[model samples]
Target: MSEKDTETVVHRLSTIRERLDAGMDRREFVRTLASAGYAVGMAQLLGVDDFLETDDGDVPVVTALARDRTDDPFSLEKRTRTVPAEWYAAVEKAFEVNEILASSRVMGYLGSAVVPGDYRSGTASVTIGVTGDSGFIGDLIGTVSDSLGLEIERFEDEEFETFEEFRDGADRSIRQPRLARDAANGTAPGGVTCETDSTMATLGPAMYDPESGSSFFVTAEHAFDDEATVVGEALTLPTETEESFDLGTVRFDHPIADIVAVEPSGRLDPINRIDTSPPSTITGQYTRWGLADLLARGEPLEKVGAMTGHTTGEIQGIDAVTCFTDNFCRHGQIRWGSEMDLIDGDSGSVSYHPDPEDPEESVLVAGFNNARTWWPGQSYVWGVSAYRVNESLGYHF
Candidate 1:
């Protein structure tokens, strides 16, 4: 169907749902309609007769990412990964379950993500995070889980700890990205050297602010030792022989996203690749589908932190809402790598997966590598997914 036709179908269904919601709970109303076999009938009405003939259990794996137009600075090289239509359809349903749980925000809910099963299984599960009482939340989630054919694994009292202890836990031990670099390695693009106290963190890909329609550099916001003291401070890139060049000035800093946006200081323009041998070009951030596909494939992500240099590791969890770090919670977090894989200076680096089709120097950003789950029984890194940054701040990379 054309986009216009799809829009019309959506509008009609939405209007019907709005009317149905008058007598029933919004959630219940939709659940009832779906269970009453409206999905197939709705598809027929919308000229999607082909959908009715497909397996009821099937899900479509589709990515929200696309090639860049002139206004989209985050666009990079184009690529695609093929998956079985059945598997894709399964994943699509799992994402729906995840969204419902996320929207409910039931008491003590931490966060949730869609995890795909083995290739042949063609199945996917919704990983739900709940703290305190599992009995209550589980019962509530069980109804939806059963209705949707989703599996729920409860993470008991899973509290996410921010890097507060990691920072306040020790004294400032500054280390530059160049220290890990070879003589042949040129200035890293994503790696930034801040003037605040010569602090270091990995530079993420260049991003565009929709409001301003201008470009800027990005990095982990937690890199600033003291935000109040260092706001608007200049950040630069170190050179081998000549003096370091002015890179940009800090423009914005926020904790939820844990990213810092910088205004270029006129010395150089922002580039999308990292600073490693055969430099990896950051084409774009992964879509929700892409991350789920990686999780299902048991893939490993790599990053080039100013301190840690380059390292690879697997994803442990995704869509987690961490609470131990602050009074509130952080949602849509990706947990991967290990404590040993991340440290103080690696905060701003990105956890990325190499493009299978173009493994030479191209990749998609998995998320930001900001902190480690540094406690017992948990031994992986955690950071805001790249898409979450765009979701929260509307800055797309």
Candidate 2:
């Protein structure tokens, strides 16, 4: 080879090496390799496909709104308000704490929720529900404070007796649980009462499973079983005509989250709109940060029950873990204050806050209003928070 030819070849190779070192044309090079049937191996090398081989247990995601962020399940970018970055980070930590405490099954632990203080305070704390004594509260706070390197002040809401934390509460006039034979199914969206072959409960908003992409009728898991769940029990909706339509069968019974997923069997489809005079569409769900913002602002939550129609109440607590009826503790529960009427037939109704961006038209689900809790002086409603439902079960509104 001639010296001039060798010099030209060496210079060209050096330029190519520099370009690769600078990550120039990286994507194009990978795509070229992918087209040659080495996509899987190349993807692994790029660390883009490692999740496929990782054996991590079930991971739940907060689903994005259907309007624009359809591809983003986490919806990290779709936040409507400008929350301070520090506050968001702290609230997320609170959520982690709530999850840990619930999963740990600490002694005297009833439930807990992440409670965010004023943004100006730049702080957040978890409010825990303990049944027997106040001794556990100090130990929990001190342990967390020691690890976090900050003074985490904790308070106790001590009540002597145990009250069943029903998310939805209605008129107490009717004591005995009777089946409402009103129009069932083929009529409205969610928020109406649904009759399982035997008992009655409200139907929740439309939710789709990320695994199958199939829509299903949703409700509280306890709604189906008067004693225990049937093999193929289904729920029915009431119409104004007093007739009914079969929506579907109870496909999934999430005992931990206390949620039930029903596969639609009849012609009626589950709609995103809440059942009202003029229906209300569920645009999105409140993120962990979003819930904290509401708690900070002392915003009110609203819901429509078959018995109560529509009612509004303030957020008393968030990130609550409740051990009311279930053998296992229910984590990430929301507690609403004030007189929010929820009742027997309202077990599956959803509690929501109006979208501050669009109050008159759309709203975001706060949680499933399952039951109201009261013991003499203390009266507030508790239910599985919407964020918990998504984070734990991966079913988002």
Candidate 3:
């Protein structure tokens, strides 16, 4: 049938249904339509002879089926190993990173749990979209494990269109790419060194705000020593604090992202602009990077953590879940590429993407550096997404 004829047929059927609903008698419906000559017109339009066929063989095959099941002759149940809290944290981190990286691949695209695998024997497996390099993936796995004090036993890598793609078998071959080192490594630029002293021996990285006149760093609940004096020597100290850690306003500590904020005593000039911006476009109108902004794969970014100094690298691949070791799983929130290696002390640092036109706006934080690549000669960075970070802490970017 022609397109126009098909439209007419659908429209006529719809009109008939309406008329019947309005109380048109079944016997009189076709008769009344014939009196109006609508039926003849429809028949002509549809090629009248096409409706005269009486071949049962042309009928579609519709079959009745029944559910089939069998009772188990012997009792049997599936078993799974319980992962520790730290291992679970790693798995979650792996999941988050893969999701975000995949989301960044497409415009206005947000990635969800792509590959969520079950825990077996001693490991959890996860897969994310393919970025530029695969070595970075290894780096992320190692980094997550070290942060949680766990190890990743087996690492399974896969490229997926969606989470279900990973679940289903596809005929595509997976490849591992080598990553390059960042341009900025082991070189310290001459700049103002801002520091804060804490009475606690184990203070995590502190965040600073030059614009809002606020500077804050987080430390563990037990960072405070007995005397409540800055545990380490003061360097560019903010000021004197009678207490070791801030207790009244806000305190955050956990196996993940562990640390409490130490409010700055004096006014702090928000340090704006990191030399990471690309040179183009208008200024001021540039967008800012925060926990809320989306991160792209293969994009080179920098991190200034408490442990690792100014380092840079490209973002690798991201996936929903990654096994730290056989027993430990780390979920990825945000995964990026980098060769500017990280260590244990680099927990809290700001990761900023360099945009030439939007230096101030580009200076955003990657919450804190969680882990590094497991094997040597490889480097990667993993952290909490800006969205998740803000949601949990109720902090504005």
Could you give the candidate ranking by lDDT, starting with the highest?
A: 2, 1, 3
The local distance difference test score of each candidate is 0.63, 0.64, 0.34
Q: How many clashes in each structure?
A: 10, 28, 58
Query: How close is each model in CA RMSD to the real structure?
Result: 8.2, 15.0, 24.5
Ten-residue stretch with the least lDDT total in model 2: 146-155
lDDT of 2 at 364: 84
Pairs of residues clashing in candidate 1: 58-89, 59-88, 59-89, 59-90, 60-88, 60-89, 61-88, 162-325, 190-203, 221-258
Instruction: Give per-residue CA lDDT, model 2, range 294-322, as digits (tens).
Output: 87777888888777778887786777777
Best by TM-score: 1
Per-candidate TM vs. native? 0.73, 0.70, 0.37
Let me know the TM-score candidate 2 reaches against the reference structure.
0.70
Query: 1-397, model 3: which lDDT tens digit per residue?
Result: 2345434544554565467558865456657557644532232122221232323222221111111111211111222223333223334444434433342232211222322222221122344323333333344334323322222222223221342332233222332111111112311111112233332121233333324535444433223322333333232322122212211222234333333455533322212223222311111110111211123212455665433445676544333333332233334344555634454334444444543323444333443455444433334666554334434553322
Candidate numbers, best TM-score first, in rank order: 1, 2, 3
